[model samples]
Target chain A: MKEVFTMWKNTKMVVLTAICGAVYAAVLIPFKPIPLIPGFTEIRPASVLPVVFSLFFGPAGAWGSAFGNLIGDFFGTLGIGSIFGFFGNFLYGYLPCKVWSYLSPQTEPLINHPALWLKYIFTVLIASLGCAIPISWGIDWVGLIPFSVLANIIFLNNFFVSLILGPILLFTLYPRFKKWNLLYSQIGEITSEKTFLQNIGFIFILIGCFGGLLVGNLTSLGHFTGKIGINLIPLIFSLILGTILI
Target chain B: MSIYLYLERNTFIHRLHPVTKIFLLLLFFILLLLFSSPLPIILVTFFLLLVSAFSRSISNLRKIWKLMFILFTFTIILWTIFLKNLNYALAMALRLNALIFTGLIFLSVTRIEEFTYGLNKLGLPFRVSFALTLAFRLVPSFILSAQTTIQAQKSRGLDLETGNLVQRIKKFIPLLIPILATSLRNAELLAIALECKGFGIKKKRTSYLDYKFGRNDFLTLLTIFLLYFLLLKIF
Candidate 1:
């Protein structure tokens, strides 16, 4: 968190962040009509970007993604939802980089080994789940969509869409970026054994995916009719635990 | 597919302070959420449309009308299924329209730089706001590069159009990769330029442009707050 502020003071990081945001918005703005769940989510080719750039450009990519989503919302669907969208997109970009750095066996992210491939996929999964939980919670909190429907929509949309596509973009761009000496690895290795991001990841996986599924099942079974508030207890508890761990 | 949303126009809505417009955007968004009745939603939708007309954003509105119509109709159908009432369906549809149109009007009328200036006035840090503004400037160029990348891939017999859902998404990688690579290269060059120009030497920075709340802004703010409270009281 402290590094985020210091990174903001650097001119090079600032410029790079601007460029990443602009390029992301450019990809997103024109694809407004290709809706998967009309009036809510869409087929976002820009979805893969956070993963790709997070690995390549580090914190700048996270800030760029957060701001880019904010600007993109002004095009349409600007509301209370935009706040969640902003933070969700930030984590979308941030978590993968952090997870990749934390979990990667190699000094830098590469696909030369089979184990690294699994780590890459795991990073995307954790990152996508991290994104879906809060956003679905936010949507449900706003009373716009059910937690079940939105959680599934966002999780599947992000995970499946990027699962195949994200790595291809990563593989395509990685060598070039590495050749140019622009990869985040060149900046420094960010892995720290003391950080609680792993606990945060496990908490998200435990609560966000499993807890959301339990609530969805209970709701469908008519066990919790008109009791959304009561139903949120365990989910909220896990979130609090995750925050406390952080 | 490349749509530049901001239109330069000399109109009352265009000339209004950006912060006022931002406030109105937020207000309309909240109002749309607050009011479930069709009448207030319709009223807000009509108000936004009237503002759009005055701003001469008809062309921009035309680009999105089909999409908005589909979304509105879908909302009505879904509401009808769940809420089991035609009027409730209509209200939900109207609410969706108000939410969408308010955003469109704001984007169409506000210039990118004016928006950044508005953020600056509202106490956002200069570097952060400027990064966002710079992103707006760079999007058009990036769009062009994306189109060229798609074309280059097409020339190599990469078919993006003919595919199943998964295949189509997979096909997008060819287009996305080159664009991303080009964007990174461009970003590195810009970083070098910024370092050369001494972008971070001074912690305290000054801006040549300024935005101030005027008599009109105050009056507009008062009217909107009154209208919002009145809407709340009425419903």
Candidate 2:
């Protein structure tokens, strides 16, 4: 997390951030005309970039994902919701690297082995949920779209794109990045050992994100009769707290 | 491929300081949120239209008119089907349009340099701002390269359009690999270029563009504040 800020001081990281963002936005803008849900989500093959770049560029990739999505929104979807979109995409890029560091440290992210493949799948799933939860919650809070509708759309969109494309991109590009000394591990400090509290924070993230999605869906869909607005506060808080601690 | 919405004009809105423009955009967001009912939303939409006209950037709105129309209709239809409330549907649609129009006006009037400079003035770090400006500059070129990659792949008999949704998406991998490889190579070169140019040597960096708080900017801020207070009092 500290590296997310400190990386800015290094010119190479800054350049990597700009490149990641430009590439992400470059892919995103072309798909704008073909929306899966007009004014909401779209066919975002660009969604895979954050996960792949996260594993490669680390914090620079996170900030790039944030700013890239912001640039994409500037094409037309820029609005109050974009503030949430920025942070959501940030988590989308941030969580994979963080989770990967904890789940399988010091190993190549290639999907050669079955266990590594499962770890990659789980990492992408968390990152997708990490992105979907806050964005749906924010848009729903703003009364633009329902929580159930947006949460499901965003989670599925991010999950599938990253799941399919992430490993392939990683397999093709990881060695090139490594050979060029461009992997985040080559540029930035290797992540330290996971602390006890970070493990606790990981649990909190799982509960908060999964619970937020389920409760938001149920409450918005009328399976639960209570107000989602009230129920989501603590979950959102836990999500935020978990990100910080992680 | 040219995605910038900034129009070159000498209108009043264009003359306002960049920071003022940023504030004005935020003000529009708050106003739209505060007034969510149909009538108030209509009033805000009308007000935004007037601003667009005054800025002489209504033509810029034409670029995204299709998106605006589709979204407007989709939001209404979705809300109507889900909630069975026509008035709420209309209000939501108007609000979304107003927000989109506000964003279009902001982009139309402010250049990317001005945007980053304004953010820097608003306390963003210089390095971050530089990255944003660079990203903006790089996007179109990357888009161009991506287009070239898609064409090359298509020339090699890749079928992008004739597949199912998942297959169509999967087809993008061939296009993505080359683009990613080239972009990474370019990124390495860019990093070295920046480092050689002493990109982060100084704590304070200077810009070629200078912004001043002119009378127009002050008047714009005063009017916005007055309108906000009036709305607060009434609503």
**Which candidate's lDDT is highest?**
2
Q: Give me the TM-scores of chain B across the candidates.
A: 0.90, 0.95
Best by TM-score: 2
What does candidate 2's lDDT look like per residue over A1-246, in tens digits? 688888998888998899999999998865433356446666788989999999999999999999999999878778988998999999999999988888888877788999998999899988998899888888777777778888888899899889888889999999898888788998899856789878987887888888998888888887887766777878888877887777
Candidate 1 lDDT, tens digit per residue, B109-184?
A: 8877888888777888888887887887787888788777767877999875566778778777767777777787
Per-model i-RMS: 2.6, 1.6
Regions of model 1 farther than 4 Å from truth: A29-43, A74-80, A105-107, A143-147, A195-205, A213-223, A226-246, B1-3, B82-88
- Considering only chain B, what TM-score does candidate 1 achieve? 0.90
What are the runs in model 2 whose C-alpha is more than 4 Å off? A31-42
Model 2, residue B83: what's the lDDT?
76
Q: Residue A87 of candidate 2: its Cα lDDT?
A: 90
Candidate 2 C-alpha error for residue A147, in Å: 1.3
lDDT of all the models against the reference?
0.72, 0.86
